[model samples]
Target: MTGKGGTGKTTVAAALALGLAAGGHRTLLVEVEGRQGIAELFGLGPLPYEERRVAGTADGGEVRALAVDPELALLEYLDMFYKLGAAGRALRKFGAIDFATTIAPGLRDVLLTGKVKEATTRTADRRRVYHAVVLDAPPTGRIGRFLNVTAETARLAKVGPIKTQSENVAALLRSPMTSVHVVTLLEEMPVQETVDAIGELNGLGIPIGKVVVNAGRPPLLTGTKVSQAELRRGLAAAGLPTDRATVSGLYAEAKAHLTRRELEESLRVELAELGQPMVELPLLPSGVDRAALDTLAAELLGTR
Candidate 1:
């Protein structure tokens, strides 16, 4: 899941993981930014580099969580390629790993994505480890540069193991199994960003997934509009228990709802033009908790 920051991409990603798990798919939820977002969402302690089962589904499928650290991934990469067991620690002591990852952000990205790709393709005793992997990737602005590691590494290393590693990572990303989903709000700037991000992802040859609309407020009056006078008259005719102040408050709410509904409709239309499957999530007035997350996960299941 990815979008402009503050679109609740992490929350959506967690919900997606839960949804997939609930469907009997053992999913691996990977967070690349080192934000511990998956941990916080699941109300657990900070997640380490090792995979741990965070939640279980109704059908007995599991959700495994991992917060990828580029440094550790680099060490693991070194050990995997070369027998750098003691030498890896020696390099860390000399700060070579730090220098390499810091000076070359692309190498860091290669390490991060390489780890994700490894998890996605990993098997035990000739059986797949994960049914699916949900990545809480970087924001829309940097996602292209982050995922397009081959292009970034080519500038750093013309031909070497690093170059070959990057090429493999890129191939995995461009493969049929990979799909990118963008989360956005029903607002002008976010919608615009989602549109632009889709275009950029298309250019990069990444398959686009659903466009998620987060935190949408439902229409107060479904499929109809009422003027203030009409609303007052209808309330009086119904003779429901209400005082003068209460009636005034209801009228004010109706007016606000009408205005918001108009704006939402306009933005919804704008999003439709992007030509991707759109899934909307309602705003949780009680804020996000376990129940809310489950509700969202169930709602997400409908998208399938």
Candidate 2:
């Protein structure tokens, strides 16, 4: 999942993992940014560079999380392809791993994405390790370049192990099984970024999944106008004070809410023009906790 910063893409990604993990299926949630966001969201301590079970569904399904570090991934890559096990650690001690990733950032992306590819395709005893994998990818602005690892690494290595690794990653990303979901709010800037990101991914032949609208508020007060007299009458009828100050305050708040609702409705209309499946997550006034995540998960799976 990807979106503009502050659009709650990470939360959506986590909820998606939970949703997919329902019904006796295993799901892997991968975090490429070193934020430990999944751990924080799930109320766990810092996660190591290894996959660990973070949460489980009611029906024998589970969610495992992995925070992929580019440096560690590079070390694993070297050991896997070239058997540079001890030599890889020695290079790390000499800061060669960091230097390599720093100088050629494309290699860093390759390693990170390559690891995801491995997890997605990995099988044990003739069975896939995880039934589904959700990648908490970079923001929409950088996502196209981030996922297009082949293009980025082409300049660095024309033909080598790196080229082959990048190609594998690219192929998986462009495959029919893969879909890029963009999250956004019912606001102008976020919606625009979602549009741009979808267009970029389409140009790259990447499949577009549902567009998620996060923190969406239901329209409480319908219609264009609610006069002060109406508010005063409603307040009086409800056995509350009908003072001028109280009536004016209530009217102002209602007006503002109505205005915001109109704006959100218009933005929703604009997003509908994109011609992609859409999902809206309600604004959780209590903020996101385990229960809230469950709520979002159900919403995502259309089981709510």
The TM-scores, one per candidate, come to 0.91, 0.97
Compare the candidates by TM-score and give the number of the best one.
2
Please name the candidate that would achieve the greatest lDDT relative to the true structure. Answer: 2
lDDT tens digits, residue span 238-303, model 2 = 999999999999888887887777788888998999999999999989888878989999898799
Assess candidate 2 and give its TM-score to the true structure. 0.97
1-304 per-residue lDDT for model 1 (tens digits): 8898999999998888888887577999999998999888888999999999998877898899999988888999888889798889999889889888899999999999999999999998898889889999999988888889999999999998899989999999999889888999988788888888999989999888889999987665876666556666778789964567767788788778777778878988988888999889888888888678778777766843
Candidate 2 lDDT for residue 207: 90
What lDDT does the true structure give each of the candidates?
0.87, 0.92
**Candidate 2: regions farther than 4 A off:** none
Q: Can you tell me which runs of candidate 1 are displaced by over 4 Å?
A: 238-252
